[model samples]
Target: MTSPATSDSAFTNNSCDTEKIHILDLFAGPGGLDVAAHFLGLESTGIEWDANACETRYSAGLQTIHADVRTMRTERFDELPDNINVLAGGPPCQTFSVAGNGAGRRALTEVKSFIKRLVAREESSETIDEELSALGDPRTALVLEPLRWVMAAIENGKPYKAIILEQVPAVLPVWNVYREVLESGDLPGGVKYRTECRVLHTEEYGVPQTRRRAVLIARLAEHGHASMPDKTHKAFTRPKAETAPTGMATLDEAILKEAEHVERPRANRKEREPWVSMSEALRESSKKLGRSEPYVVVSNYGSGGDPKNRGRRTSDQPAFTVTGKISRNVVETPDGQPLPRFTIPESGILQTFPSNFPWRGRDQAQQVGNAVPPRFGAHLLAAALGLEEGRVAEAIEKMDGWPQISEEERERLRKIGCGDKGKCPTKPPHPQG
Candidate 1:
């Protein structure tokens, strides 16, 4: 399929300045940031590496360049709209995820050293490449790709007005280093920006999962102060006491009183609605299919290759963070009798993908797993654009619904599996996206 037309502006400029605000999303897996930009009535283009994710982006009518961000820089930048004001990306985080093999943690010190060397202009071209090659795992340095692009754009006199990046919380310190470099105007070309780095819990922003992301937002050339987004939903707090089983139930009487007497903690009281749970989001969908009460779901609790890390999620709580293996999540009855695994549509719902959004191509679960929840993304974009509170709330609500899917698409995704040896109940050679 052909790419979306580049001639058309992604968004119009309503401000006194004539330049429009288009977003260029680097490392744009499945176009999550683009989806959020669209919700705000903005235009965006994404550069993604994986073919399956690119295919999903294409099928959904999103503008995308199906190539690696590292290699696509020159050609893709040349095609960017004149007013590409915002740059956003969520670089692949497996190398930096806390739940993974300690590669990210172990490499953190070296990654920070690299960032310092990069900023200090201490390494020659040969040494830079040699050192990156010598790292224990080079993927840890993928987080620096955005910084490279930012410097390049600035040097070209086309610095993005706003920059946004998100990753697993383990990447926070790296973002902090980026914040220092961007704010200090330390680059050879001397571009200065204001940046804020923070850890954001997705549930606080109304995503129906407890995912935490390390986020950095920047305004180029100190155009304005950069602020992290405010939460739109109530934060889920556990009792001070260690309640058995769920670890969130009852606390000592004094502790409960202390909790009530203390400040509400969250900023916005008017909009502090309760957290939406997996049961609440999926209940109606399940009932529509005549599934009975007492739904049960079993899936991995953490991201790792080990089976021991897998666990279950009751209907009452929001699901553990959805991962690339999400399709393997089993839906069962009360007695542990397995029903169907979560259909692709249901998994999308959990991840806040619009209902019926085309999830075609290979590695559907990975594509879905890696995506930023559109609602959460919309909230962050709204904050970036300084959209009014009313408008932010409105956009989020609109994104919360399921996209309508046709039976043909549903049938196509039925029995979706990884298709690895012995992994599929069906036959070998599972359909590739």
Candidate 2:
């Protein structure tokens, strides 16, 4: 279990009773967190870059800004409504991701440049080093991005009362940096926070996906006694004589299959054509897209438990960590062709993203491969929003209007991402909201 952030117990919150929360989603790829906000009837705005993602956001009627967050001024955002309650998201984790850590290491230089978007130039690197010195050391510098923004908030005396972040376990090494740079720093007032993180399984959070993410929440409220969000779902798997059934969600149970009556364009069939064996799509996509060589799941395994468990293990019980490099190989095909690589929609389902959610970018594989599922993002948002227990369920209402695809609409989408061949499995075209 991950330790709780410094001390949510520090103080009881009094402001939430008096106001509604507005969210500013940062590095907000496809707005998974916002989807939860929508369900709750809350309003949110997101910043994402990628033509496809932009198109998706607009089509969904979300107030989205298509821009590089690292290029925008974090401080300038204060101009947004004062009711803004939370800042939440799983930032682009590529620079901190375990897969292609070599790629991450090389990309760190670009990631580091994002700091300028937060800290003022007058703030010396010495100041940053000094503050970080007080917090714990992080495995990768990517941990500092959130801290930079949080520290800036405190420096400006306009801190968002709460902050939330999500990533994979590979990001834990940088905890010390968070403690020192953000928590340990002296803020405008006595305002300071403690950091805590846990490795959380998305399946445990009620999402069918077996995604495990590192979750952290920081609060301005003093830590007298903090409270962790209660888990709503228990772990389940196939029942065994020796072990009780671990009723884990099958890939089928987890995905939202076709919406009934999707005829004439009302069907919500979001689930991929039920896990077609790698008969033709794979071979044809291979030939058409020249994807002849099988792709790899690039990452490392944990030390404890079976080391073999660290790498890929095909099972109905658990899934390999999601990565940008999904392949037909993770689960394996009957013909030994590897598990059929997910269509972007299937990838989103695995990530707990809702159907009809749009993804942006020329690289469908890379974007879905890198995104945090919205369903999981919703949990983190619930924690950040300090939502009342039963109330969190209300957020699903926000998706009630998540737009629909008509037969005409689906055809239009297939034309853009797939063309005439029907081999491309990218996200649907953005149906303008």
Best by TM-score: 1
**Where is model 1 poorest over a 10-residue stretch in terms of lDDT?**
424-433
lDDT tens digits by residue: candidate 2, 293-381: 43433123432223343343333333444556654325443345554455665455555555446654466666666666665666666
For candidate 1, lDDT tens digit of each residue in 1-433?
A: 2122234422222111213667888877876787777767788888766667766776666776655666556444565556676788986677666445445556766777777787776666346545654565556557777887887787777777678888887777778888888888787577777777777778887777777777888765435556666666777663232122222122223223322322225455476678878777767667766666576777654223335544556677677677887777777887888787776767777877776677879888888889988878887776565566777677666665534545554434321211121322222111110
- Against the true structure, candidate 1 reaches a TM-score of 0.79
Question: Per-candidate TM vs. native?
Answer: 0.79, 0.61
Which residue pairs come into collision in candidate 1?
A: 355-402, 355-403, 361-433, 362-433
In model 1, which runs have C-alpha deviations exceeding 4 angstroms? 1-19, 74-76, 122-126, 237-271, 302-310, 400-433
Query: How many clashes (backbone N, Cα, C below 3 Å) per candidate?
Result: 4, 44
Q: Distance (Å) between predicted and true CA of 64, model 1? A: 0.7
Q: What TM-score, to 2 decimals, does candidate 2 have?
A: 0.61
